[model samples]
Target: MTRPAAPPFAASATDPIRSILMNTLIAPETDQRRPEFPTQQPRIEVVAPLAPGDEAILTPAALDFLAALHDRFAHTRHELLARRLQTRVDAANGRDPKFLPETEWIRLDPEWRVAGAAPGLEDRRVEITGPTDRKMAINALNSGARVWLADQEDATSPTWGNVIGGQRSLYDFLRGQLEYTSPEGKEYRVTAERTPTIVFRPRGWHLVEKHLRFHDRAGRSMSASGSLVDFGLYFFHNAEALIAQGSGPYFYLPKLESHLEARLWNDVFVFAQQELGLPQGTVRATVLIETIQAAFEMEEILFELREHCAGLNAGRWDYIFSIIKTFRSRGRRWVLPDRTQITMTVPFMRAYTELLVSTAHRRGAYAIGGMSAFIPDRRNPEVTERALEKVALDKRREAGDGFDGSWVAHPDLIATAKAEFDAVLGERPNQLDRLREDVEVGAADLLDIPSAGGEVSDAGVVDNIAIAIRYIESWLRGVGAAAIDHLMEDAATAEISRSQIWQWLDNNTVTAEGTRIDQTSIVASMAAAVAALPRFEGDRFDDAISVFREVALAPEFPTFLTVGAYARFF
Candidate 1:
């Protein structure tokens, strides 16, 4: 069946009121160009050259579906993002967030539950997450985990090549034709008998894909929302095929701040399913409760998408960044120490996770745990052993706390994580029955950041500077997940690092070594980090340094570093 065409934007010179409304809702401008196509049909203009194999995924039908999504939801997305900024401003002015009093009835209602798990998602004891490159896709599918989170957001750099090429790779894998040969002649392919269930993660609501402009307004082009573009292209090309194979289109929704955003996604799902002639709830999604605001509204979020909800995930790094971002202006009480010091065992984090487990279990949804960022260092046995011990302990904690499953970055860590879950869930697929009635979390408990006690140290500051610069450099070079100092560093980690630096400097945090962290000290650290790095061929590092300073030291904190960096680099 053919999908319906999207309505055109009000581009006529006579429609002054419609043009004013559109301009007010959308951003000021973007670097998008008009497509060479007839005016009646939807147009998808590509800003970059399509890679050799990109045609397999970016077919005409796929582009039309994407344009339809843009037309339907792009305006809503714009308004939601503007709401986010206004909320932040209110938060900074001491309008602290709490459970929505209006939505309390939804949470109090006892007769509701999220839909049952989709086929192949009944047991998610171990899920490996990474970018969608061909080699990584093959490795993750063969990693013996129950699910592979093919990430296109935090773990991907979103270069035009990476975006189109990654979609091509997923298409090839779904068709059982994906294979890769290394420079040393080693071949890799998916294991037919034990491939993990695929769950795709699109970009967050804050980002935009400048390469694909689908609408024109006032003689300027409008870029498609990145989240819609990713979701539309993937679902258009693969949804029916996945359902035929007994699995359906699954997603991990990232960086959502409110139940309203969840409602938006549910509406999109409804529209997409109806347009494609699929049954309701054909797409199941796991909401990542990674924001401080989202933690308070878990039940509401689930209710908004209950028909299409699979579960909720505890996203650790981004959660930290969100706390800092939401309360950065609240002074020392909200100032966090080193990122390394804030473990899951801390009071605030414990409150967050325990509430998550109880809420998900109560609603008959799976409660997934955070990622173990340790990448095994096989070269040094002691390093590998120590890291494995830490990972095992973390997993054991999550499983014992009633998490149905957990995330790991490397294949080597999967066995270790699964073993812990196996111990807790012997002969059982999950622990969704363990509804912890003892979990009594309040706003004060979730906001008790000061209980995490650790003084910032010189070493921590230097490490933050080093990791931010290093990760941003790799990000600029089109690599999202980089192994640095035996940990898998991605955009979330970078966000935490740079944000901590800004927080410390703004609050005049005194380090353990009797030195005060300030703009001068941070600048010195940045220069030192740059000089200590091994020689690189390109100016990407220089660009990363500039971007890092702009975000970290700005008078006003930018909501996301990736948004600015994407425009600057891509």
Candidate 2:
């Protein structure tokens, strides 16, 4: 009368009639298809880089796609209006290093598909720090990023595969160079070697072009082509070319905060694709809105990149810093903590995630959660559970918030990360008809905000320093911790102020708990920074404003940093 769980214990094919009778009563009522992002006619156009014309020798998928493309669109030219409509702007117009990579060797020109942008934001890719090197990069790749960043920026170490090391890694991946050792201690090899899954994040384009003058043994140019561009310039020159190369990074746009920023990126994509002979809209981009202004303009920024952008990400660590910075300047009650731990609390995290989810899902875009820099202990006895715990917590938060996926640092964690994310994205199906409508016709209002001149100007820098100094000094003197505020010792709002107290414990600039200030490095960095800035006269003018003008956030900077010129000023 009933179906039992264990079939192998008793049943066989002869029970089909019984199985059918049981199925009629107990079949599950579940959606057959997992809910998928609505698909569209492919928007990217791969121009021929070889001899023929607009078609290059196709990969299997490309060949099938090309055949289908010709069959479907051979009668149409309006299909290409998207590429032709790229912004007609000059590349030389950019003035900010923040906007450009050091060189334009590999520019990321993203197109904002109609699916991924919010109502107001256009998709604009900005550069964040490149991620760590190859093996970990493979980890990120399997982690399912729409964009894979091989970090050369802040996330990498100098000795352990930094710029030069990164370049070697890239060329090796590109060339498919690899070897191995046998289990019996015999040196053998892998018969198959493929490029590391993520794209290469070489040294900063500018850093490579300017500083790294590596030569081969014969004193020849390390590169036969001496025409290496900086990050920004290479983006200008080779973005489209990189796309054409097929094996270069598909692209992951980084660190953007506004629609105008997206516009500039779009314009760069347009010019590079057109002038440099790469396919239009092929180089995808993802944006990192890590600053205050970026949060407000999500809709506009996303939509603007509809033609060239990938997806938007909530850059948590940087975004958190930006949020506190904004509050310090704009809120009547301004304060920030010194420790990173206290700063990232539930409330703050919720606010960030809510805004991010609402914005990303509104347009059907992939909501990629931020990174967890938990470098694993390979030798640890309990590594598996430790990793499992880490992934479970992260994915629980991400899945509950409806994220498409999350990122991890090492390949070791890939299985756990994938399992957790895949579990969350269970098969909830939806139809494309309801999702894809022409909604952005008059929605230009979202993109119409006048771009705020960012925090790079002299006055802006001065203001930033002023707030930083006040916060730091308060921590040093122990005034901030006890002052009128809503804070725990661990809160970001206080960590920036109470860190020296923590520093006093272990000669570290900051720790979770403490009662006194470590004035050693604090005094040094503040002194250096104070020397770097303008000094206002005062009889014992050691408070924030004077300290700010002297050291851009004088008291705290030195507590954590060693001696350096930027320690004081630019």
Q: Over the stretch 1-570, how does candidate 2's per-residue lDDT look in tens digits?
A: 221231121123244433542232222213322122213322212221322211212233332322222222211211111111121111113111122222121122232233343221221111112344444333443443333456544344232223333444344433444232446765433232222224323321111121222222222222111112112223432344444455332334444444555554565455445544666664455566565556656666666666665466666655654443333322212223333233223454555555666566555555567655343555564755665686567766765666655555455555566566556554432111122222231222221211111111222222233335544444333222211111112112222332222222223223223222234534544455455544445322264444333322333332121012112311
Model 2 residue runs over 4 Å out of place are 1-147, 157-161, 178-249, 327-332, 337-345, 382-384, 427-570
Per-residue alpha-carbon lDDT of model 1 for 243-326, expressed as tens digits?
988899999999999888998899899989987999998999999999999999999899989999999999999999999999
RMSD of each: 5.3, 23.0
Ten-residue segment with the worst summed lDDT in candidate 2? 83-92
For each candidate, the alpha-carbon lDDT, in order, equals: 0.87, 0.38
Error of 2 at 347 (Å): 2.3
Q: Per-prediction TM-score, please? A: 0.93, 0.49
Q: State how far residue 309 of model 2 sits from its true place (Å).
A: 1.1
| TM-score of model 1 (CA atoms) | 0.93
| Residue 374, candidate 2: C-alpha displacement in angstroms | 2.9
